[model samples]
Target: MFDGMVKIVLAGPVGAGKTTTLRSLSDDEPVSTEMPLTDGPMGEKTTTTVALDFSTVMLDDGTPLQMFGLPGQDHFAHMRPIILQGALGVIVLLAADQPDILTMCSEWLDAIQSITPDTPIAIGITRSDQARDFRMDALRALLAERKTTLPVFTIDARDREQAQQLVRALVYSFA
Candidate 1:
C-alpha cells in the first residue's frame, strides 16, 4: 500500500493534542520545536509548537512512516501547507472540551482538504474525558453535510495504542 517513507500530517487548533499524539506514536523521542507559550496560558499547556513536531514510527511491516505535526496556532498557519506537502494522509485532532469543537473540525477539515485535496483524511477527537456537552454524532452529521465521511476516533493522545490506531487506519486507507 506504500513505497518509501510514508508522510502523514497531524493538524488542528491549539491544545488539540497534535503534539501529544505525535509524541505517543513516535517510536523514538520525537524532535519538536516547542517553545514556551509566552502568549498566555492555554489550559495546562505552558509550551507550544512554533514550527513543527516530527518523529518516525515503523509499521508492523517495517515500513517507516514519517510523522510531521503542524503548529496548530493560526499565527503559524504558513507552516500548514509546508508540512502538508507530499503528505499521503492527514489526521486532524480537536479537543472535545472546546465549545467550537464542531466548527473547528470543519475548518481544519476544509482547510486541509483544500490544501491537499484527494488525500485521505481522518479525525481524532482528543480530550474526550474533558467533554461535558460535545457530541460525536453532531460532528459526524456535520461531515455528512459537507459530503465527507471519514474514520473518527475519540482518543487520549497520550495512549500509544489509540494514537497508533489513527495512524494505521490512515495508512490502510490508502490501500
Candidate 2:
C-alpha cells in the first residue's frame, strides 16, 4: 500500500446498488448527497443521490481509500467528470438481469477513460442470489462482448463481509 490514500468511484445504472455498496464497505454508515426523486411514475416522495455518496476505508498498511458513488440518472451525468477527478480506479455495479448493463458499462468506460484509461476496474454482479433464471457463464460472455475484462463476482450489498471482499479485490488490482 502507498503512504497516501487512493480514491475510487462506484458507478452503474439505476437500482444497481450504489447506495448499498457504499453502506457495506465504509467503516461507519456512509454519508450521502440526496435529492428528491420527483419525476417519472413514482411520486415526489422518492429521494435519490444528486451529488455523490462518499466513504473511506483504511487498508492494513494504513492507506485510505475514498470511495464515491455517482448518481445513476442521466440528469446527473454532468457531474461524472468532476466526481472521477483524483480517482485511482472504479468499481462498476451491474444487475445481471438488466439486459442493458453492457450499454451502461460502455458509457462509464467512455466517461472515465480519459481520466484513467488503465485504471483497475471491478464489476459487481449485484442481485446474483436472486437471479435464479440466469447463468453466470452467460453473464461473463455478455461482459466480454464489451471488450472489458472486469473481474465479475457476486456481491450482496447488505452483507458487509461480501462487500468488503469485493472492494479488497478492486483495491488489489491497483496495489
Candidate 3:
C-alpha cells in the first residue's frame, strides 16, 4: 500500500464533464459547489460549478487520492490556483464536440502549466461519442507545439473504468 495522499486537479471548459468524471471515480459522495446556471450558452444543463468539486478515492494500492475539480467558467478562473495548490498532477478534460477545442485545451494547459510547471498532466477527451470527426491529431499537434508530450485518452466521463484510467495515467506519469 502506498503511503500518504495524492492530490490531483481536474480542469476544463464549461460542460466538459469535470464533475461527472469526479463522481465516477470517487469512493464517497463528491462535494460540489454547483449552483443554477443563470447565464452562458449552456443548453439543457441548468447548474454550473461556482467554486469546486471535492472527492476522495483510494487506489488499488491503498493510496488515498484527493480529487479536486476546478470551476470551468472563466469568471471562476481565479479559483484555479487555489484549488490546484500542492496538486501532484492535473487532468484536463475537453468535450470532443466543442468547436473551440484547441483553444480551450491550450488555455487550460497554459493555466495549469503556469502554476505548476512540473506537474504531470493527462488529457481526456470527453463526449467522443458525440463528435463525428474528432481530431486527436489536432490535439497532439498542439501539445507538440508546446514542446510537451503527455498521455491523451478518449473517455466517457460517466464511465467509472474510463475515469479511473485517466487517474491511473496521471499517477503513472509521476513514475
Candidate 4:
C-alpha cells in the first residue's frame, strides 16, 4: 500500500529508449524535453532528450508512480543527482546495439550507486531486436562483479506490456 507517489528513475545512454519506455508505460501523454539533435551517433533519431522526460502511471492498487527519465548524454551528467533525488528505485536501460553497451552500463551503474547505494535497480536491455548475439550471461557477469543482483530483461521500449513488466519488476523490488 502506498500513501503518496512513488518515484522511479529511468537512466541509460543515448538512444537507449528511455523516452520511449516512459511513453509506453505512462497513462497520459508524457512530458518530454526532447530537442532536435545537432550532432551525434543516434543516426536517424532527429530528437533527443535535453533535460528529462516525465510521466505518471497508476498501479493496480491505485498508487501513482512518477517516472523520471534522465538525459542520456554525458553532458547531462550533472543533472543526474537532481533527477535521482528521493527516487524509490531505478530502471537502467541499455541499448543492446550500442557499440559500447557494456561500458555505458558500467558508467550508469556506477553513477547510480554513487548517488543511491541502497535503492533497488532493474536492467532492461532495449533494442534487443537489432542486436545480434545479445548476451545475457555477460551482462549478468558484469552485475555480479559489481556485487549487484538485479532483474534484467530484454525489452522493446515502445511496447506497453514490456515496459510495464519492467516497471513492475522495479516496484516489486521494494516489496
lDDT of 2: 0.77
Q: Which ten residues in a row have the lowest lDDT in candidate 3?
A: 37-46
TM-score of each: 0.92, 0.82, 0.92, 0.92
lDDT of 3 by residue, 58-159 (tens): 768877878999999899989988878788889999999999999999999899989888999999999888799989999999999999889999998889
- Local accuracy of candidate 4 as per-residue lDDT tens digits, 73-115: 8898999999897899899999888878788889999999999
Candidate 3: global Cα-lDDT? 0.89
Best by lDDT: 3
Q: lDDT for each of the candidates?
A: 0.88, 0.77, 0.89, 0.88
What residue pairs are clashing in model 3?
A: none
The C-alpha local distance difference test score for the whole of candidate 1 amounts to: 0.88
Model 4 misplaced stretches (Cα beyond 4 Å)? 1-5, 59-63
Q: List the residue pairs that clash in candidate 1.
A: none
Number of backbone-clashing residue pairs for each candidate, in the order shown: 0, 0, 0, 0
Could you give candidate 2's per-residue lDDT for residues 4-72 as a string of tens digits?
557889988767888888888888777898776666433222677888899888878878878899988
Decreasing lDDT order of the candidates: 3, 4, 1, 2
How big is the positional error of residue 63 in model 2, measured in Å on the Cα after superposition?
4.0
True-structure RMSD for candidate 4:
1.9
